[model samples]
Target: MVSHDPAPADPLSLHGVVPPTVTAFHDDESLDEETTAAHARFVVDRGVHGVFPLGTNGEFPLLSDDERDRVVEAVVDEVGGEVPVIAGVGAPSTHRTIARAEHAASVGADGIVVVTPYYYPLDGRAALDHYRAVADAVSLPLYIYHIPSKTGNELSLSTLSELAAIDAVAGVKDSSKNVPWLAQAIDGHPELTFLAGSDSLVFTGLEIGCSGAVSAVANAFPELVVDCYEAYADGDEERARELQSTMFEVRDAFKAGGAYMSGVKTALRLREFDAGPLRSPLRLKDEEATAELRDRLESIDDLEW
Candidate 1:
């Protein structure tokens, strides 16, 4: 297994709580660059280790090409030096993913997270060639985003091993939520940095040797996840487990009334941070559901929000 020592020259060596930050929009649903940048700054200020824009939580697929580039630019401009900005540049097509990755690199992103090409069933060879082309398109480190649940495409172990062999393919963000699969992948490829892509699996992923997490929950409660990660990193396993339980509590509370996608933004608004509304087809929980969410959150003695 690779040592946990920091690799100054390797962007994939990034660890700790990296929030897949939410993209902000005005009431009219227009991009709000100022609020978007502000959210990045807020997370960094709260001691998050890195910032990721244009991921599932960021509503990447809902955005246009120009808007995607703008989000990366806004985030990088706001917190590029403060923390690594690993922008999500994946698309359903190889060339499109490459274009987005190139744009992210140009805007000063530290690395790129490429979700598997979705909507089409891809065999191993197609997946391999797609990633290879995208990796070759830019000098930035490439991280495979494995969220088969949404993409309807899963990378087999053999395929993951092959992807790990690419010089530019540096890591993975696993939202598969399959512990066995993640464990085997991490064991088979120690050289590649592994990040837990789900808030529900952050601690479990760390237990299996993930370097860190790309948490959706961290978008609103960065410090909560950060504290959990730090507890583990500091060799306080008991504390880490306690924090993990707290994280699950928050996760459950957020998911109350089916607020999975809209919870983070709503939490941000409740905390007085402007995380504007989610785009079409994804609306906030209704008032009754939201009130239940608020009550649940307030019941958590440790969480200030």
Candidate 2:
């Protein structure tokens, strides 16, 4: 494999609202490819810049290898070149991650999102080696999925700079909840597209030189999310701030209800989609949380698009 620093395209090419779409299941917990694609169609139709599936929000770690690839294929087929589709191929093993990246490429994903290998803590050098190997393995551009809270592997800023120098690393999705770090990272490397993974930071991220966000709230309010970005882009700072605040409120409400992914599924079910039950070790037993989400969504629904 060659190591070449291609001239950065826009330095913010992978911007805007891209949802890590939730996988749909039937009553019996069978993979519901139809509804999964339908939700992708829903968000794309509502005007997102891209679609990502099989992230933490999408239950990637919980899914079988076959399920992961199938979800990517279904979304790609349904999206049909309408929007760039980035599929998460993060696995604890580098071998499995490579296989997932290859499968994503074969299934028509525009790029791949790779989270650092978890379960055991790794130093900067080890993480760099892992990403470099995967970068060499696939031609599709790779975006680092840096969510330490769930993965137990926190990527340091210095380490991130080293990783960014690699030829194939196109961007990063920062879910560390560190605005200062995000701002500093974006400034440090203006070449790699930086995307915030938190909804509350959409406006702040963009304001601080981030291209856009890879969001969970976007699974429900695609239009609203895009509108917020558009507002910021259009120079309506006030409008953008207002929308961001609303999304922050929604985020807090969802947090109050239950966990991250489950609340997102609850939002989908509220809007009349078939988001079905969560997989094992997880259950939708919180009616109070669901009702809270419903009311909050209703308030959002009443907001003018």
Top TM-score: which candidate number?
A: 1
Cα lDDT, all candidates: 0.87, 0.83
For model 2, residues 36-116, the per-residue Cα lDDT tens digits are 899899899889998998887788888899999899999999995787898999999999999999999887888899998
Pick the lDDT winner.
Answer: 1
Query: Residues 1-305, candidate 1, lDDT per residue (tens digit)?
Result: 22333224356578988898899999889999999999999999998999889989899999999999999999999999888999999999988899999999888999999999999999999999999999889999988999999999999999999998898988888999999999999888777888888887877888888889998888888888899888888888788788888888888988988758778888887789977789987887778887988898898866855
Off by over 4 Å in 2: 1-7, 10-12, 300-305
lDDT of 1 at 304: 57
TM-score of predicted model 2? Answer: 0.93
Clashes of each: 0, 0
